[model samples]
Target chain A: MSMTLEELTDRTGLTVLDHLEQQVRIPVVDGLQAQGDLIVIPLAVLDDVDVPARARWRPVPPSGVELLRGAAGGNPHTLVAEPGAAEWTTEVHDRQRLAVGVLRATRPAYLIHSEHGGSGIAPGTYLVRRQRERSTQRGGQADFLVAD
Target chain B: MRPTSTAGTGRRRSATSGCGPPCTPNPPTGNAERAITGLYALLGRRRPRFHWAASPRQAVDLLDEPPLRLGGPVDPAAPWHVAHQLADAAHRLAGRLDERAGPVGTFWWTTERIVRTRPPADALAAGVSLAELLVVGVRNSLGRSVHDGLRTPLRAALTEAVGEPPGLRWHGQHDAPWVAYHDVRRRLRPGLFHPDDDRQVDLWADIARSCGWWWPREDVCVVTERTGVAHTEALPGALHGEVRTHNRHGPAVGYADGWGGHSWHGTAVPAWVIEEPTVERIGAERNVEVRRCAIERLGWDAYLDQARLTLVAEAADPGNPGCRLQLYDLPQHVWGTPARVLLAVNGSVERDGHRRRYGLSVPADLDDPVAAAGWSYGLSGEQYARLLRRT
Candidate 1:
């Protein structure tokens, strides 16, 4: 079922609040306007992100899923598309440890690859929560509400 | 046509013709122009950046300047032997250079190895970047190498570079020190994984190197193995090693492998519990089982709802389940701005299943009697801040 961006925000803490608040004061050309149903937010960026308090909200760590950095540097986090092959696929040996996940209905549709190695779950969207203020956002953030 | 004058080493350039070209032709005689043209044709394709000498005399003069030599001793200066010696040195040093050194470093190293001594005054003016010299070496070394077969060109190139005559040897051990780290990279990485694409191999190699784990040849799959889970299907020939078991021959009470699977309602296992040696698992189980009896009574959600922090224990290991009492705190009400605090008590008792799926809310400060029951599981202040910040 398709959910609005607001409902998506309620279920999964992913939001474009930081982007909205930060860009609100910046003066730009008329052509430079934000648009799109898919709002991408990086939990963290190398650049400064100045957002507002009204838009701030705590992120609940996704239940039954833990974000882990690949053995490679950058502490990159990803969801494997095939949770069953996790041991051989994403683990040290397989060399197929790609970051896998997509934002569905503004919630993280992660490929849960855990030590258990396999899951009965099919390759479909599953709601996931971000770790508290992981400081990155990606996916659709359309409603640009400035409540301040 | 033997080298015009070998200095009597009898090591004719012909000896390495089978290895690849730029096999220095018969040293220039009266037909210096003919010899110079042939030399340029043979080597220029690969090292186009280097200025070709207009005549044999020029080629010989280029060598008059001592060239850097990397792997062996200095060659004697002999004008008659100049062209041949340079060719020989280039061929020998080609594959020997390390890919890790990158283009510039490899160039510098190659020149030092080939020149055998200081370069001529006009070395830079001669018009060749260090990159050209390296290209010559790499190309020559790789030229004769077959691209595919049981003995593929990749293998041949590796063998030449490693300087190990019969070629690569595989022991299947991740940490085979004798093997050049690059040659047996596939085995060094844990798993029965083979990259189907070159990019995959590169990506894996990058990750492996970044982890500072290229040596000691550890595999992720190997370390992930636990009791009862047979890896023969997953790892094939690699499961010769055994894990620490509780009762030398006791039944393998392998972990659930799924998170929160150790509890009565658990479908997975805990990582911390899995880390404890097999022997420790037995003792830990008895303690966990007894606590499970209490938790089953308190009711899971009811116990969790009342407290701000929840301690979760699973059935994997009773003693070191790594389960802790997670205490929740809100400092904003007592101080100013709202702040969340998560205190994980390390030394909590396992008598009751409270450590597993139970929460406790204490007063604003740490004066509660439960605070003294265990040490704080080492979450530093910075970590706590990261954990608490909402945005």
Candidate 2:
């Protein structure tokens, strides 16, 4: 009872299996993305089947492509997320997200307090404060002054 | 790419590359060409590695490589990448050195340029100091570190990619803790800044080349040539003319004021604050003493209070650099050019007067932050970062 991807697409909205009841496998496209937990049921036996809109097939980010390279290329071993990676989740958005973030080295900065040494004890937390001050032209920021 | 052993028989790995062209060399002919070709043949030429495959797959192509957004998962400019990069650098640094040298606080900063906004003193009541800076350096309310996923290999690769001359690096156990420094002053010449120039380089860029002096210079201050000499009218005072940018921008060099004075060198910064007393650098020991007395006599609380009313206070006791140095710009930071400065004064009372504006305003870039170039003329973290960019 094998079904064709075209026939399956007609029956269901899913991207159906291209092949059925065979050992052959199809390669994943270069930039195509996998949503959530990916289970490839090769339609060769079933893997190549067409699943409908059950999952979205969108182009992944260049970085994401690298991150999920194996899954995209049908490498079973590499497809598994890194040990502590979060389960894959699909996100739909209206506007593009230009999210920028930075991470600091949190593990307490090493200080020389008894544990390390003493004689050379010199520096401590060198706290640097950065500010954005706009200097005006001509009189230069006459606006910031309190009226005389 | 695989973990290949160097002792291989002429076999090198290769990957599909879409790069427009390959690095070319002089096309040798005749004897020379034959000799080189024969040598390559004898050595067994193998395809070189091309890691950053536009396609996605591995976290990185191979060893000593890093992964960042190129195509999909995240915006190339995501701060997450910055955070991660910092964290990665710190992690690497920690791994390299003895962790027992107390906790190391890696100071990461950046800078940018933009049309200055003459925001009144009241507009920005908040100015940063050491204690407050401590908080900003930490992770936000989110337990995640602020620099959690930022990837800035550029900063790390600075030493490796030397253009003119190799940048000067000062490394040693500062107080037994490993402190490696590479500043701008080492590579650049002084007297590079021309206050008259409009398109000037930011501060930190210059410092990256010299001043391995590590951030806070012992004695550093910028005074605009436009107003260094005392008033042209000798007035009743001595012939010492009065000079003052009045905290304005044009030809005005915001001096970095610190005994252990801090140098602002970065692409961008958050904020910078310089108390009035800080600029008065007479002698090394005297300077430290005066500040100690100033903070003590003025009361630390009063200093904090003036945190907002900067202009008024700076006016009350305008920065006096004795005789103004025609060298107004910060040579260590600005890379021989003046800077787009922002002024945020503590204290209060508002009334727009003469000065126009300097430094970048948030209006240009939606995501860009609004910040001062240091409370005075120094570059903020963001400003410093901007200077680090290649010309």
Candidate 3:
């Protein structure tokens, strides 16, 4: 299931900058991994999140799904997988309210980004959460989602 | 079953690529005059006197009366009101075209939102048709760029420079949105609209491509030339060829009469931001967003050093080996809020192979840097301490 950055970009038609190393095989990690403002955590690692019974799941197409876009809006963190190997849903309830969606993959899935490069996920179920920082505007104590 | 063939997709014929209106400094006045004459003919009136101005600011001085007479008794003997006639004709034409374009259901609404916000490639990947892409391109995206991005700020700057405009005016180049919308629809579907409506649409399109702003009066029409210089950059994450005004050193948009505005990214700011971003000026600035933009212009480290914010706590970042997260108390009077700043280093290295430092605002209550860092990720201090890797 391991693939190099070059092969992954070619398969998905998503691109990374020429500066990133293209030949090295991306590691398929089963544990936690962070890419910029997004973090991927194994479902078993946390008990605060739950996927509802009636949650609708969408198959991750060959073109991939854009999980998050960078602050200035150019770079996108895209999740891609082989046909029929993965599915995604935003129906999960998180206690922290940071979870963007949940990813369930029967085969290896890779998250590709133009600046941060690629992060491979081993076959498993995981929760993808966006990072947030405290907001200082207007004196409200609510946290704002981190964009980058 | 999914349709595998691209027969009716209109991918080849649709002009989705480079669909935005041209931002030309010198527009063709000849075509514009002809279009205005055609529009006058449609209203069954003789052509009005055409007065050309080098810029909108100059055109404002040429008006004898307010463009819109808000509330007044209509003279029964008057031949016609040019503005009202033009508006009514355009509205009826749009109504007929909308009927032919089909009903905009929930699916169309959702797709339109995606087309407006995300990249065109993303919309295409989501199964949006090429024709729909063109619709959003010429309408939503072009409107965002020409009207919202360029015209709005320029109008504001003009208002600030001169008092409120004395007359009502129409944005000639900025009207590309609606004009191009009708033009694209008729061009794509061909027989979808009436031939008469098609001719009217063409005249409006010609005016859009040939001028800047204009004032239409009963006996006279005043058309202004385009800006002498306009600087813009790609709107981050735009689905079409959308752009916003931006210039680091000077005015983003400037006219022949020396009227212009300065912008950072897409946010319109005072000329001082681009000219002289001094710490003293930034401190006195009341707007939080403006203050932030000024601080960014002067690097975070430099601002923190010059402002001399009191340090509260510092801790070694959990995952980032050598970097330390530092917290500083923000002055209540200056910030107008109870908050602290957490300075941290970027996890990923830039193209230069050096990690960058950034600051994030945090609630003033937290004194522990690790706890503040944990708060950012929705994890407890102990939970975040076990972090393994950062990209």
Candidate 2 error regions (>4 Å): A1-134, A137-148, B1-20, B25-100, B103-391
lDDT score of residue B348 within candidate 1: 24
Q: List the residue pairs that clash in candidate 3.
A: B67-B168
Instruction: Name the best candidate (by TM-score).
Output: 3
Which candidate achieves the best DockQ against the true structure?
A: 3
Ordered list by lDDT, greatest first: 3, 1, 2
Compute the lDDT of residue A20 as modeled in candidate 2: 26
Error of 2 at B157 (Å): 19
State in Å the error of residue B159, model 2: 24
- TM-score of the first chain in candidate 3 relative to the native first chain: 0.96
- lDDT tens per residue, model 2, B223-286: 0000011101111111111111111111111111100111111111111222333222211223
Identify the CAPRI category of the predicted complex in candidate 3.
Answer: acceptable
How would you encode candidate 3's per-residue C-alpha lDDT over B84-149 as one tens digit per residue?
677678788778876777753234688888777766788889888766776777677777787777
How many clashing pairs per prediction, in order? 39, 171, 1
lDDT per residue for candidate 1 within B9-89, as digits (tens), equals 222223323422122333321122232233334434221122222222222233233433344554444322333443453
Model 3's chain B TM-score?
Answer: 0.72
**Fraction of native contacts under 8 Å reproduced by each candidate:** 0.00, 0.03, 0.55
Chain A TM-score for each of the predictions: 0.22, 0.16, 0.96
lDDT, candidate 3, A1-105, per-residue tens: 799999999999999978777898988888777787888888887879999999999999989999987764558899999999999999999999999899999
Give the DockQ-based CAPRI class for model 1: incorrect
